[model samples]
Target: MPELPEVETVKRSLERLITGSAITDVNVLFPKVVKSHTPGDFKASLAGCKIKSLARRGKYLLVHLSGDKTLVIHLRMTGRLVYLEEKDDLPRYAHVIFYLEGGKRLVFADMRKFGHINLIPTAQLKNMPELKKLGPEPLGKEFTVQYLQQELRKRRTKIKALLLDQTFVAGLGNIYADEALHLAKIHPERTAQGLTGSEAAGLHHAIIKVLEQGIKNRGTSFSDYVDGEGNIGTNQYQLKAYQREGEPCSNCGTIIERKKVAGRSSFFCPQCQSSKR
Candidate 1:
């Protein structure tokens, strides 16, 4: 799953590659990938539209077209957007190809076929279910310590579960959540209500710091994530938690441990993060 950093990286890459280019054609190799309308309608709606800009909200990519229709893409698990100078052989998983005017092609490929694309009217974008439900972005100004405390106070869910909740804090997925929690020295199993104001403040800082660093590192390429240039991210090399199951903790030298929290694998050092609530 490409979280905020990964999605942000892709948005930047796509913006550079496809902005101002006209979509001369759209080939939907997988009909299931088009959600807003039939594949024909989706293709017709975007064929001649010029891509004005590319932006991101939460984990969704927003490609703003000239006529105010937004192309929304969620690279759910294994999806990637690659920019090619020329089409020779489409990747085995290429599901959607947007033919550009200059012979360039923007390809969306998903090996697992879980990604989705929707052509939406920009006027209705704010009210769309996905964007409407997202909380303030952790990297944005609205996500302050006071705001985080308000959202977490009295919430009985585990801290990790609360962080993973899209409505609780937008743009966080498994990797960054565990990294933030580990940085804050908070146990994933601890209830949100158990956190003190200082703890919340620490978490507030941790979230922003880790997200900024993730973006700087081009996002963690734990799986099949890549930028528009077909480049694999190298942030996996800098991970403090998330997959170093039995390795020694970088900060305290305690053995890094893994457990299931909120049905997602959590990585942390037991010594660094106290589980006692």
Candidate 2:
């Protein structure tokens, strides 16, 4: 899945490419992809509206448009949103296409078909169930070390699982969760409340560090992710723990290992991230 950094990168790219451009038409090839309004209503709402700006909340991309409508897009897993010239052939998996006034196209493609687009009143965005329950952005001011400590102390869930909960930290997925835990030297199976003050601080810093680095690299492109300009990200090369199982640890000489934590594959160095609390 494209997490916070990938979605944020797409938001930045689309903001540059399509801001102020009017939507001439909208094509919903897969009607079910329109999760909120009917496909007809969705098309009518967006056509002729100018894209005011782009923003990302958690893993969701917000397309602020004229006429007070905002298109909230979630690129769940195996979803790709790319900007292309009208002269280019459409991608086979493109489920939604927005035709811009300047002979450009913004395409939303998903192989798994789990991606969704929701058109909602911008004023009601705060009350929208999808956006309402999301926790503070990891990079935002609200996600302080004290905040993380408090949240962690309140949960008995496995550290990895708690981090993956959108309502807990917002935007952490399997890859980044494992990376943050590895960086903080916290075992994935450890209970959330088991961490010491120093461990919580380390985890907080690790979360911010990895996310900033991911955005700097334009996000990890292990699968279907791409920026708005159709470029794959390079963060995959910088990964330390996510998919490096059996390799020597970047910090310690011990071999990295992988196991299921809360039903998700988690990678860590046994020597660096001890199971003891």
Candidate 3:
């Protein structure tokens, strides 16, 4: 699944490639991918509308269009957005295609069929069921150390589970969670409420640091993830703990280990990330 950095990278690329371009036509080959409106309505709302800009909330992509309509996309598992020239062949699993006036087409391909698209009024975007419940975006100014401490203080669950809660901190997935905790030197299984003031502060800094680094590298691409331009992310090469099971830790040379925590695979250097309580 694409995390915050991957989604943000996609938003930037899409903004550059698709913004200001008018949607000449829209084709929804997979009806299930359209969540809110039917394919006919989706097509009707988008036709001839110019894309104003692109933004991201949590893991969702917001394509602001003319006429107060917004196209919301969630690249759930294997979704990839690619802008292809007229001469290029459509990639396999191309479920949605937006034919632009400039002869370039934006293709949405998802092999798992778990990705989604919805057309909603821009005015109602805040009230959308998914967007309404998402917590503050980590990269936004609203997410500060004080904010993270308050949210963590309320949760009795393991630190790993609390970080996974989208309502508590938007845009963090399993990959980033493990990486952030490893960077902070905090055990994933430590109780959220048990974190000391210093530990929380370290975690706050580590979260921002890891995410910023991920964005700097464009995002981690362990599988098929890529930006809207089909470019692979370079952050995976920089990961220290996540998916580095049995590998020596970058800092202390301790062997990194992986285990199941909250039903997700978590990686950490046991020597470094000792339990706080």
Candidate 4:
């Protein structure tokens, strides 16, 4: 699953590639991928619409189109978007292809078939069930330290689990959550409400720092993730704790360990994040 940084990278790349290009036609080979509207309606609604901009909220990609419609994509697990010339062969998993003007095509390929596409009126996007319930974007101005502290203080769930909750802080997934917690030196199993003021502040800073670094490095590409241009992300090489189990911690030389928390693998340095209470 691509987290915030990966999604944001895709957004940026797609913005550069497809913005202002008109959708000449839409082919939905996998009807299930069209979540909101019927396949016929989805194709009809998108045909000839020009892409205005691309943005991301939480883990969803927002493709703003002409005439006030927004195409929302959730690239669950194995979805990949690539732009290719019409003469190029479509990838084997290509499920949705947006035929654009000037002989170009934007393809959505998902091997796992778990990804979804929704078309909603731009005005109604904010009230849609998917976007409406999402919490503030972690990098956005609304996600302040005081906001994080207030949200965390209300939860008795383990700090790791709380961080994974989308309503608590949007755009954090297992990989980034582990990285952020390790950087903050906070144990994954610590109760959220038990965090001291300093710990909360540290965590707030760590989350932003790791996410910004991840974006700068393109994003962690541990699986089938790639940018719109089919390039791998560089952030995977910079990871410190996630997937570094039994390796030396970069800061204190403590052995990095992995444990299951809330049914997800969490990586941390035991010596660095020892229970402080």
Candidate 5:
């Protein structure tokens, strides 16, 4: 699944390619790919409407259009968005296509078919259930160290589990969670409420730092993720944890380790991130 930084990179890349391009037609090859609105309604609402802008909330991408309509997309797991020219053949897995005025098209392809599209009125974007329940953006001003400390106090769950909860902190997943915890030198099994004041502050900084670095690297591409231009990200080369199991830790000489937390695999350094209160 594309996490915060991955999704943000997609948003930035798509914005440059698709903005100002009017939708000439919309093709929904797989009907269920659109979670909200009928195919007919979805087509009617988007056709002829100009793309005003694009934004990302959590892992969801918002394609703001003229006439107050917004198209929300969640690239769950293997979903991918690509901008293709008229001569390019449609990808075999493409489930949705938005034809543009210049014969170009934005194709949404998903091998697992778990990706979704929701078309809603822009005025209701805030009240949209998915956007409504998401917690603060990790890179936003609202996510302060004080706020994190208070939220952590509300749960005895492992800090790694809490970080993966969208309602606890927006736009985090298995990859970045391990990286942030490793950066802060916190164990994945540590209870959220057991973090010391210094640990909490360090974690807050680590979260932002890792995420910023992720954007700088354009996001990790261990799987099918690609930007709008179909380019793989470079962050995979910069990861210190998360998939570096058995490798030496970047900060300490200890070997990096991997384990499952909440059914999700996690990577950390056992010596650097001791199981402590």
Candidate 6:
């Protein structure tokens, strides 16, 4: 699944490519992909509306339209939103295609068909159930070290599991969680409340650092993630712990190990991130 960095990369690329372009037509090849309204209404609402801007909330992409409506997209697992220079052949899994002015195309392709789109009044965006329940963005001002320390002090859940909780900290998935924990030298199975203030501070810094690096590298593209131009990211080559099981740790000579924590595979250096808690 695409996490914060991947989604943010797509949002930035789409903002550059599609803002100010008018949506002349919309074709919904898979009706189930339209979650907010019927496919017919979805198509009718978007016709001739200019794209105002693009924003991202957690893993959700927000396409602000001219008529006070927002197109919300969640690219679950294997979804890709590609912007084409011309009206070429539709990609194999293209489920939704938005025809822009001047013969351009914005295609939503999902190989697993689990991705979803919603159209809602822009005025009601903040109060929507999906946006309302999400926790603070890690890159935002609200996610300070003090805030992280306080949150960690209250949770008994394992640190890795807590980080993966969208309600605890938005946009962190399995890959980044493992990387952040490895950077902080904290065991994935360590209880959140067991972390000292210094450990929490280290974790806060590590989380922000890893996320920033992920964005700088344009997100880890081990699977289906790509920017709006369909360019694969280079971050996968920069991974230190995630999916590097049996590899040498960059910090220590110890071999990286993988363990299951909270039903997700977590990779860490046993020497650096000892399970002392």
lDDT for every model? 0.91, 0.92, 0.90, 0.91, 0.93, 0.92
TM-score each candidate: 0.98, 0.98, 0.97, 0.97, 0.98, 0.97
TM for candidate 1 is 0.98
Cα error, residue 179 of model 4, in Å, equals 0.6
lDDT of 4 by residue, 1-277 (tens): 6899999998887788889999998989999999888878999999989999998999999999999999999997889888887678998799999999999999999999999999999999989987888999999999999998988889999999988989888899999999999899999999999999889999999999999998998888998999988889999999989999999999999999999999999999998887675
lDDT of 2: 0.92
Minimal lDDT window, size 10, model 6:
84-93
3 or 4: which has the higher lDDT? Answer: 4
* Poorest 10 consecutive residues by lDDT, candidate 3: 268-277
In the range 64-99, model 5's lDDT, one tens digit per residue, is 999999989999888998899899999769999999
Between the candidate structures 2 and 3, which one is better when assessed by TM-score? 2
Candidate 3: lDDT of 177?
93
lDDT of 2 by residue, 1-277 (tens): 6999999999888788899999999999999999997778888888899999998899999999999989999999888898989788888799999999978999999999999999999999999998899999999999999999999899999999999999997899999999899999999999999999999999999999999999999999997888988888999999999999999998988999999989998999999999997
| Over 4 Å off, model 2 | none
Error of 4 at 157 (Å): 0.5
Q: Candidate 6's residue-wise lDDT over 147-192, tens digit each?
A: 9999988999999999999988889999899989999999999999
For candidate 4, the C-alpha RMSD (Å) to the true structure equals 1.1
Segments in model 6 whose C-alpha atoms lie over 4 Å from true places: none
Q: Which ranges of candidate 4 are over 4 A from the true structure?
A: none
Superposed on all Cα atoms, the candidates' RMSDs to the truth, in angstroms, are 1.0, 0.8, 1.0, 1.1, 1.0, 1.0
